[model samples]
Target: MGLLSKSRKASGDVIYNNEVKPQLVAKDGNIHIVMINSFSKLVNQNFGVESKYTEQIGSVINDLQQDGYEIVDIKFDSLKGQGITGTAEGFHTLIMYK
Candidate 1:
């Protein structure tokens, strides 16, 4: 088996706990964190349940702020239709530090 045989993709919480937390503990300076999520995959889906990417992102921001991180910037953008034939896709990004 490989070193990652039992490992999986880390969730936001995992990243915060294992990576961010350690850095914060070892350093007294500000720590920068950037998170990005795309909604294009769900844009034209027929799933009955509403997607909560936006809400989840907000929750992460709130949690980070509560943990002492300051919001540095926020950006939202959409990819315009390609060649005037493709549908536009949206994305959200957040930059925080400390």
Candidate 2:
């Protein structure tokens, strides 16, 4: 008879406890953070619910920079459908020490 053997292993999905929570760190001895979200969504939230969301997104970005949040980077996802060619799906941003 063959000898019996036992083995153990561990595996599971990693649950994110801090998802979407703003992280602030000391970079170069200054406060730093990064934000990621849909720009169009934000504008829609801040401005109106039924208006054209894309143009408002641009306005919101400009306004944010004007308020001095160190808009370091801006990127956009692809657009879809018609009457919304310049529309961006979302964006990622890196805010430097401020």
Which one is best on TM-score?
A: 1
lDDT of 1: 0.52
For model 1, residues 1-98, the per-residue Cα lDDT tens digits are 33322132224455556554565532257656665654443354465532344444555566567787777777666554422336635565655565
TM per prediction: 0.45, 0.29
| Lowest-sum lDDT 10-residue window in model 2 | 7-16
TM-score of 2: 0.29
* lDDT by residue (tens digit), candidate 2, 1-98: 11211110000001111332234343344555545343333223343442333333344444445545454555544333223444434444433434
The local distance difference test score of each candidate is: 0.52, 0.35
Instruction: Spell out the clash pairs found in candidate 1.
Output: none
